[model samples]
Target: MAEHKTNAMRLLDKAGIRYRVWNYDPGDGNIHGTAVAAKIGKPPETVFKTLVAHQGASLFVYVIPVGSELDLKQAAKAAGAKKIEMLPVKDLLKHTGYIRGGCSPVGMKKLYPTYIDDSAMKLETILVSAGKIGLQVELEPASLAAQVSAKYAPLAKRGAGEAASN
Candidate 1:
């Protein structure tokens, strides 16, 4: 079966960026980032998820490892906001033009300030949602960051009971 192109893919194509699409089975009903990473055969740390947050009138996008969670305080500091709150799931599509489990930092309805976890710098490439559930785009982290005009910052909070190794 031919793969369907998403807005994120089209945007990358137009910019002459190269990427590999990994399609996984979503029939299992598990669309969580870590599970998707396992299905795609990539380490959880290499598969990132896009999260959207807002502070009053401003919206921000964050890309962090699937195995980790976004630390709101760190995110606010990274984005220079007084405080950041996760954008309600109901309001996701209205603000980002993408739904949960498929939001890509790239090719959003608007290019909000984006921040990628600096941990991505340790990997040669990273995978992120391809604007659709069950699909991911793998590309160089720097390339992805440049495409989205994103800055690299410390934004991930390790899972509960996980120690900081760095």
Candidate 2:
């Protein structure tokens, strides 16, 4: 196994959350979906990816399943914010200490507003990045959210109902 260390791994340690690390080749330059599809052999829609967005001066983290996108307006409505926007790549990296594709909802540089898609509750467990590309962790969504003090909301920009109706 390829040994790796990342802030996400550290957070799990801090919380005493049980997790199993899965590593794969970092090549192919695939996004989170591709990695999940290849590694777990699951459809991309079943894999969730972490995202960073902003509500005024504060930055928030949103973790939603892959194949779905974060709807700024929907997220703002869910979070009781008048406005929300995708955080700048630079600012996101600085605040979370994680680069894109490697960002985890846990172990961020600073704790800001956090929201996890309610859809996650449907799954027994899900995979999230291990604070680095090519590495992922398997854990329960509810447990993961509790460890990070995250809240649940309708964070997806789309739904199976055809309308992101939230």
Best by the TM-score measure: 1
Q: lDDT (0-100) at residue 105 of candidate 2?
A: 82
Superposed on all Cα atoms, model 2 deviates from the true structure by an RMSD in Å of: 2.3
TM-score (C-alpha) between model 1 and the true structure: 0.93
Clashes of each: 0, 0
Can you give the TM-score per candidate against the true fold? Answer: 0.93, 0.88
lDDT of 1 by residue, 63-117 (tens): 9999888999999999999999999999999988898998999889999999999
Write down the RMSD of candidate 1 (Cα, Å).
1.9
Q: Candidate 1: where is the Cα deviation over 4 Å?
A: 28-30, 159-165
Best by lDDT: 1
Off by over 4 Å in 2: 28-32, 159-166
Q: With candidate 2 superimposed using the best TM-score fit, by how many Å does residue 17's alpha carbon deviate from the native?
A: 0.8
Q: C-alpha displacement of 107 in model 1, angstroms?
A: 0.9
Give me the overall lDDT of model 1.
0.91
lDDT (tens digit, per residue) of candidate 2 on 9-112: 87788888888787766676456565565776766655789988887687778888777888888788777888988898878777888888788887888887
Question: Residue 14: error of model 1 in Å?
Answer: 0.6
